[model samples]
Target: MIGEMKAQQEEIELLLSAFDRLVEIPDEERVVFRTLIERKTIPAQSHFVLIGEPTADIGFCLSGLFRLYYTTPDGIEYNKNFCGKNEFIAAYSSLLMKEPAYFSIQALMDSELLVVPFRNFETLFDRHACWEKLGRKIAEGMFISKERRERELLMLSAEERYRLFLGRYQHLENRIPQYQIAAYLGITPVALSRIRRRLT
Candidate 1:
């Protein structure tokens, strides 16, 4: 029991450190934020959020990997994004609109997350300017990421996208399956293999 408590404490410290990197939080505000957090573990191949389900929390990945994907009517899945340790994941549009999520978030590996209700954060936004700034920054970052992804898909060649993917997710290459990477690049697994050969 003591060991579990100590581990939870360590995770909380890590969460605080991550927040500190983004924006400074006053001790009182930090305490309030801490109270809002819940530690969650998602096993490999399990989902944190599913399509058409309401998601009320935003998760900070403490460890492990996740993929956000959308499925077609025929059940084909298209990879939209990947989240790794120290990253945040949420169905932002769904949360903001108070609707069911359009995409699903699945754990690619056993993952631990620091979860907080979006509503809790919304409350904090009214209490402090720092929280508001943090929220704004997070939103801006998401917007930039979305814009970049769209540009890459529209303007870049498959080979070029593969190169960019390597540069951006080099550490995750071995950890993620090649088929998923191919899906993320919007290419067939065979094409991805050819690209790898051409690069080598």
Candidate 2:
């Protein structure tokens, strides 16, 4: 029982540290947020968010990896993004608009997440200036990440995209599958193998 409590405290502190990277949470607010948040365990290959499902909670990954992907009606899947430890993952559009999610969030491995219900979190934006500031900062961060990815995809060659992915997420090279990386780079697996051979 004591060990379980300690583990829970550690998870809370880990998530708090991640939030600190974006905004400083006062002790009182931290306590409140902790109360509002819950810990969830996702097994490998489990889908956190499914296409056409409403996103009710935003997750802060404490451990493991998650991939955001979309599948066409024809069953073609494309990996849009990957979120690893200490990062936030959500179907932002669906969360904000309370609509069906366009993409799915899937666990690449067994993962632990700190999750907060959007309704509870959004209410804090009106209740506290700091929360409002945090929300804006989060949105700005997301926008900047999206814009940078768009530019890279538009201007960079397939090989260049692969190189950029390596430079940015070298740690993930072994953790994620090559096919997913190829999909993210907008290239086929065979093409990715050729690029790797050329670089080597």
Residue-level lDDT of model 1, residues 104-181, one tens digit each, is: 999999999999999988999889999999988788888899999989989999999999999999998999999999
| Local distance difference test values of all predictions, in order | 0.92, 0.89
Q: Give lDDT tens digits, candidate 2, residues 1-200.
A: 99988898898899888778878888888888878988899999998899998789989898899999989899878888899988988998888888999999999999999899999999888766888888888788888888998898899999999999999889999988899999898889999999999999
- Model 2: residues >4 Å from true position, as ranges? none
Each candidate's TM vs. the true structure?
A: 0.96, 0.96
Top lDDT model: 1
Candidate 2 local lDDT, residue 40: 94
For model 1, the stretches where C-alpha displacement exceeds 4 angstroms are none
Tell me the lDDT of model 1 at 120. Answer: 88
